[model samples]
Target: MRKITLTLVLILLLVQSLFSHLILQENTAISTTSQFDTGDTAWMLVATALVLLMTPGLGFFYGGMVGKKNVISTMMQSFMAMVIVTVLWVVIAFGLSFGPSLGGIIGNPAGYVFFQNVSVLTSWPLAPTIPFLLFALFQAKFAIITPALVTGAFAERIRFWAYLLFMVLFILFIYTPLAHCTWHPDGLLFQLGVLDFAGGTVVHMSAGWAALAGAIFLGKRRTPNTSPARITYVLLGTGLLWFGWFGFNAGSAMGANGIAVQALGTTTVAAAAASMAWVFLDKIWGHKPSAMGACIGSVVGLVAITPAAGYVSIPHAIFIGIFSSWVSNVMVSKFPKGKIDDALDVFSCHGVGGMTGMLLTGVFASKQVNPAVVDQGLIFGETTLFLHQLVALIGASVFAFTASWILFFVVNKITPLRVSQEKEELGLDLTQHGEFL
Candidate 1:
């Protein structure tokens, strides 16, 4: 009886030891994952806040361009986007974007109804410190701005109820899929090596193209365009956007590393150069440079450098900022003649500027800036990066323009996309919201 009891005790001890070892191994592996870092979390938090600021900045940017009678209505468009988009993101849109891949076209349904299994510590491919939830909020800000950007094209027009309905469907079907294809780790476009860095193509190009489509569908705002409500608002919004963009660009690095710093510096330089370039272009065109031009010019520079922020040098950024601004300015000037009245010129600024940035990124990206492509350069030494950039630009533009055109037409048919002519002339503030601006 004593011998049997001793044998049982020994067996129990062996089992306990094995279980302990397995637990230790599992813990060790988890600890070593690239996602475990405080610095990354902190950076992402800041990035999220920065991106959130852009919505208000965008509100002011668009607000200042429209007549005072519609300023509140215009600003409300962006505000509503923030609220509506966040809800959509958490419930369905987020899953469709970052969930498990479905044939590399979109994410699976696993992450739908977020908060079921996800937490703040969930690791994403780029930002590991934050939970998938945080990433969702960060990306949500991008999604919000995209539809808001379209508001600029249809400013002072479009029924608020109709716009709200359009935005809901647009986020689910349009923005979510594009985001997945461009940023998801297993995304088809990502696999193809399309380097957007910070949404030069995904965010800006998509919004730009969609804006064009919306403008086409909605027709033009009321005639006799009035001066902006407050230039001060525009400047304030510009400053905020500039400040927030650091988070937008640098935060994309997903780490507090040298790359993030480089991206920040390049972003600043490009904006400055682009501002100067716009001023110079205005002078050459025999027009006195306005404060609005300076602000818009800086924004153009920022848009142009977004794709190249982490992939190119400061010198290349300067050239990109200058050249893109020139192109956008010309486009904005001539766009009206084509019978498309882009109210705030969202297509000219974000669309044309983003395209220029993507193309320039191909021409300017060097192996030195990004070691991932060490054998590639664009400064008369390597040409493959340029070709890669060109492919990205063509692919993004074709997809954005084509998809947007179809979506707009379909939505327009289902429900009237534009407001009645009388409502538009009466101003959205009163006609849509029953409020005085």
Candidate 2:
């Protein structure tokens, strides 16, 4: 165990040393063309804060759904990402994600190691009004939450330290490449004109597939307790997640412009519509309209509209919400939980919801909403964008799921990923962290 840990640390240090270089000799080297705009900058700062808040919100959300003995362990998984991923992002993950293009596949790790060229004086090419440092900070929040979202799958059975190792590997290999592909200007998906207004593909889809991999890898928990630890915690987390989603969707516009306003409106209506649709659907299915159903439905709606928030109209956003909610709800109902044991249905809500949203974006996206769209959606009689979205969805999902399963296997080899049967019965709060609620 000590040898494995030492080897991993040494490898990381070696990579850091190899990539470390000064990309900017002086701040004057930055582009003079992009002028600073205070209004956009201010809004982005707020947006960054809102996005960061979602991690702890996710903690509460996942924590409440796990057994009481594992509550702290579950929430800590989310909180730990804020610390671990933040440091990694500053060190090399950010550059690996958004640095200069490397053949349209990934960023050059040497381009911005240690955020060497990122500064208040500089700005990202995409978000010209905000400081490059601020842009990096905002993106770091997304990186932080992706692995955190996976915790819900194997919530009660994962070893804390092993999970940390898996998180690091997953970010470096899986998340960064996907983010680069979907978001960076010169990336393959971006060049192919794949539209992801926020992160239906980059964040939610990756997390969802990774969760499925985790559920399968970790197997079923020893105790099959399904009752949530606290419904109130789930509600509190839902409130925080909904509030923070405005920033998640609107903030993707990278400016406080009309596009951002449209995104906010769409995000709002989508969540509301999905929440209502979920409860009504529950009644139709003969189940009582439960708060848990409402929360999950709203989140699924948020996930579905994310890729289309800025590209689709208000009414189309509602349709995306309704359709995504129904699909995810059905997926949750039909999932083989007794065998696969995705403790919180993360794959159903996030993976299926994100895919639904991505495809619907191809159906509802309009050039009228954003002139950057090269082609209108299928509804406007164009098939090109829809085809591109479908191709991208299948490709991205395959990569995410395959890479995540390999990561789980590698991490398990280095250190056991699942707790022992004895430890599992004791609960992770005691066995993993020696703390409990």
lDDT, each prediction: 0.80, 0.91
* Candidate 2 segments whose C-alpha is farther than 4 A from its true place: 1-21, 24-28, 31-33
Candidate 1: lDDT of 391?
78
lDDT of 1 by residue, 161-216 (tens): 66777787778777778888888989877777777888987889888988888888
Deviation in Å, model 2, residue 295 alpha carbon: 0.7
lDDT of 2 by residue, 79-161 (tens): 99999999889888998899888887788877677777778877888988888999999999999999999999988999988
Q: Each prediction's TM-score against the native?
A: 0.88, 0.96
For candidate 2, the TM-score is 0.96
Query: lDDT at 84 for candidate 1?
Result: 85
lDDT of 1 at 142: 84
Off by over 4 Å in 1: 1-35, 374-377
